[model samples]
Target: MTEPMRISIVLVDDHPVVRDGLRGMLESAGDLAVVGEASDGPAAVELVARTDPDVVLMDLRMPGGSGVDAITELTRRRIRGHVLVLTTYDTDRDIMAALEAGATGYLLKDARREELFAGVRATARGESVLSPSVATRVVSRVRADTTELSDREGEVLRLVARGRSNREIARTLFVSEATVKTHLTHVYEKLGVGDRAAAVAVAYERRLLGD
Candidate 1:
């Protein structure tokens, strides 16, 4: 029988001790391998592109840089954006930022070793893995909001999620910049978000921007 391939991963965290622990814990799983490690966002981006691992196990709120920024950088560089955030933060802001930045999974640091192992594997397979707590919060928000984004507003927001500026979005949609801003304002009202970042985050939550 052919051997099953191990899921390749890169660990990114500011703390050496945490990275070390993750490396040992993950490698012990027998079906996973840590191919690289980085202590900060910039290093993490370079390492991920060079290594081309199956999954990236990232930590948010690193002092060197944030995992959200790293994820956005990876997406901007057109790297294989399969990032799984493993951090202590379970806040709504943290979760939404990571998701809008292109993370495939979110696992709290409190996850069991086995759960982390499974989360990495699931992330490698292009699955969305959210811890129970994160899942609850996401669900609650989704249920709380039923107002929908209009088709034009949704289109504008989708372009926003792709990192397009107002001018760029306007040009692409053949509309004036003022028109684009108006659509965005309506979107913000409907989504109950203040800015583009928060709007994109909530759009993903409501599944308005489909994968």
Candidate 2:
């Protein structure tokens, strides 16, 4: 029989009750283990270094430091763990910043117990998860950023919005598929989008393409 995947977790929250509750929930899962807890970002980093958990459930606004800062530090140090942000704030800036800082997932504190558990498991497996509400905010922010794109880039984005594959886009633009793919990459970076669906949604929202 295949062994169940073992997950070591660290909880980083300022509230004791929250930490305790999470620990209980996680421990109830046969394969999940709580290795340590931290009341602030600094403590979280220290505990993570010591425990070397597979995942870190990080709170955004802590007393000693910000979760984003912690993520930056951990990523810089090349920590071998996924950071799953668990916070009350779902602002676009916060979501984008966390993702940029190397967080594997973003989930609101109000998530259902099952959803939280699923997020932890998915993050441990290297999947990127974001709350639906947070995703909408991120889409909006990316759309806003598209206004700065050059005309050619806008053309490429419009083709992307129209559901054209890179090859099709290349044919339409009389350019190589590799060039089209490169343009798409630039569009994604400029819009801060990680995927084609997001790029299309942002383009539509910004009136860069007709819906």
Candidate 3:
């Protein structure tokens, strides 16, 4: 028989009941093990260092520090675990900050049991899983910013939107491939999209490029 993938997890929340409930749910999954629990951000960091879980289900608002702070600290220390934020806050600022701070995934507190379990596993596997509502919010914000691109940047973005490769775009624009890459990077930041496909979609949705 193939061995099940073991996921070591750490739970961090201010409420005991919440922590207990999550622990029970995680433990019931044969491959998941709750290695440690923390009631606050500071404790969470200490336990994470000592236990070295593969994934951390971190609560955003905690007593000693915010989940964002914990994520920042952990990343600075070069910890290998992925931080999957499990919080009630769905504000754009909170979501963006957490993502920018290196959180691998985000799930709201009201997520179903299956989603919670799936999210933990996904994070352990280095995949991003955003709650549906959170995903919509993020997509909306990116779409809203698509108009901020410069003309040359927009040209690069339009070609990118049409599934053109960087080399192809460079050839079409009579520019160096390195210059095309530079424009692509600027386009990504301005549009708030992570990659070429996402940037292209955002440009089309926002009418930043002519169809």
lDDT agreement with native, every candidate: 0.91, 0.88, 0.90
TM-score of 3: 0.69
| Candidate 1: regions farther than 4 A off | 147-211
* Candidate 3 structure lDDT: 0.90
Taking every candidate in turn, the Cα RMSD to the unseen true structure, in Å, is: 11.4, 10.6, 11.1
Write one digit per residue (lDDT tens) for candidate 3, span 1-211.
Answer: 9898689999999999999999998899888999999988788889999999999999998877888998888888889889999999999989999998989999999999889999999999899999999999989877665448889998988888777898999999999999999998988878777898888887777788875
Global CA lDDT computed for model 2: 0.88
Give each model's clash number: 0, 0, 0
Q: Model 1, clash count?
A: 0
lDDT, ranked from best to worst: 1, 3, 2
lDDT of 2 by residue, 63-168 (tens): 8899999988889888899999999988777889999999999999999988999999999998988898987887777666644777888898887777798889
TM-scores for the candidates: 0.68, 0.69, 0.69
What is the lDDT for 77 in model 2? 81
Reference-based lDDT, residue 196, model 2: 91
Model 1 Cα lDDT, one tens digit per residue, 121-146:
88988899999999998776665576
* Model 3 Cα RMSD, 1 decimal: 11.1
